[model samples]
Target: MKRLRIISFVLSTIVFSTTLLTTVQAQGDKKSTAILDAMSNKYQKIKSFKAIFTYTPDGGKSLKGDATVKGTKFRLKMAGQEIFNDGKLMATYIKETNEVNLQDFDPSAGGDLDPTRIYSAYKKGFKYAFLQERKEGAQTFDVVELTSTGKNSQVDKVQIQVNKADNSINSWKIFQKNGQKVTYKVEQFQPDVAVADNFFTFNAKQFPGVEVVDLR
Candidate 1:
């Protein structure tokens, strides 16, 4: 469960942070704010998106995952488990156990377990600054730093690299107070993909003999 929570939170940071950028306040270095605004504008135009990413924790093995998101709905697959959130309920299915845990989804809850609150949490506790422009191959990236303002916050800092040409996130590294760091990089991104709303909902009929546990 702990691993699942961490993966979900990090994935949400990569996915929803881009989609919900407009809600973030323009309180940062002028350059950083401008860049963020541009990125926000670009993602706001996307009705839906699918992203493939890899995340590695400090001194830990790396794992790759994918997520499909539209509005407040998202379906994430990683580490032999799948999580579905339809802006109403959340279902976490474990393939090995063939068990699904269901719970009510609440975006207003401010915590790491709540994927939808990630952006709001960042907005509330972090301040952004423009770092520098980085070049790799033929692509240039805008590097930005987010420092935690609250002493009690678990996050020490975060560094994000945004692709200059497309205004998309290339990667992000989270630094925790315990000296642990996790890096997440986007391997692929597909925007404005056509998907039905039901894709974000888990249907029991799809998995025969699966045990459903209602935790709501």
Candidate 2:
């Protein structure tokens, strides 16, 4: 369940842009590439960001959590688990087991589950296209669809909704081959916030009776 949740979260993480649709082809798609590039550029400008998100997997109840990210470092907390990555090391704490798994931070590790790597991954193995425009209340959004180029990829497709006004990501949905659909809605987002380094590190002393397993 833990692994599935992490995978679903990773698959659902995406940002979109409002570039015009100029082509339908996914590979070397001019408009889609431009939109993705713009979104990536915007992300580079943010010093830090925090968001309250609700993750709902198909056939499962929704889970709420908050995440703070600074560059490649992030701290993600859900109901039973919390993951901390301080740009060099990563620790995953499981509340049920009262255990923490520590490992060296490999940018390539965790595949899509690694929050640090998702933005860049789109450029390589996927084809993207502008889907359509959508609106929710007063805010307008631009939707984009991403399809994996690899035939055997676990993710079938991903849809991202970007706020047209602020160029912020509103939400994303991931479709998996195994009939699981995971959606992540960004309820609140604050950019350029000051987050301390300590927030992304794990302190074992804080967890009494917790077993620390160092895999590094």
In model 1, which range of ten residues has the least summed lDDT? Answer: 110-119
Residues 1-216, model 1: lDDT tens digits: 675566455544554533352265655889987776676667767778898899888899989989888888889998788989898998989899999989898766534313443433445567889999999999999998888887766678888888999888788898888898988888998988899999999999999999998988
1-216: candidate 2 lDDT, tens digit per residue: 465356335523533111122233336467667666666666667778887889888789888888888877788877678888788988888888898888797765444323665554566667788888897899898887888777767788888787777666778888877877888888888887798999999999899999988887
RMSD in angstroms between candidate 1 and the native structure over all alpha carbons: 2.6
Against the true structure, whose lDDT is highest? 1
Task: Score candidate 2 by lDDT.
Answer: 0.71
**Could you tell me every candidate's TM-score relative to the true structure?**
0.87, 0.84
Give the runs in model 1 whose Cα sits over 4 Å from its true position.
1-4, 17-25, 110-123
Q: After superposition, how far is residue 204 of candidate 1 from its true place, in Å?
A: 1.4
Q: After superposition, how far is residue 157 of candidate 1 from its true place, in Å?
A: 1.6
